[model samples]
Target: MLLKYKYKLKPHKSQSVIISNWLEIARKQYNYRLAERLNWFEATRTPVNACPLNVSVVPVEGIYQNIPEFR
Candidate 1:
């Protein structure tokens, strides 16, 4: 058997302000990372379901391959 306890936080005015600022910073970072991922996918033309580091098939010289089909 196990028990879990949960509590809500009630911060002071200054603490709330600090928390709000941190939340804003976190949101900005999240958006930046999402945009970076989108840009990488667009540039590489890779599917979101495929792993970026998997390069099983080596391309021949002077030959360009499209994004490999992934299951």
Candidate 2:
């Protein structure tokens, strides 16, 4: 016979706050990467190759400064 178990997490106040912050950061990164892929596709009309993500033609001065450098 086989048995399965499931558990639910109940975080405290501080832990919940930390989790929220981490989730927010992850959401921002996801959006930024998605935009990068779309922009690349629009400009080249081709799929991305083995090129590094840091080789973006877009500027990072104003709006994208918060994104961590992958290089």
Q: 36, model 2: CA deviation in Å? A: 0.3
Model 1 CA lDDT for position 43: 68
Q: Residues 1-71, candidate 2: write the lDDT tens digits.
A: 99999999899999999999999999999999999989887875534565556555666686678878897
Clashes of each: 0, 0
Query: Each model's TM-score, in the order given?
Result: 0.63, 0.58
The candidate that wins on lDDT is: 2
Instruction: Please write out the lDDT profile of model 1 over residues 1-71, one tens digit for every residue.
Output: 89999999999999999999999999999999999989876766767798767553445642556556579
Q: Which stretches of candidate 2 lie over 4 Å from their true place?
A: 46-71
Q: What TM-score quantifies how close candidate 2 is to the native fold?
A: 0.58
Deviation of model 1 at 49, angstroms: 14
How many clashing residue pairs, candidate 2? 0
Judge candidate 2 at residue 56 and give its lDDT: 57
- Candidate 1's C-alpha runs over 4 A off are 46-71
Pairs that clash in candidate 1: none
Clashing pairs in 2: none
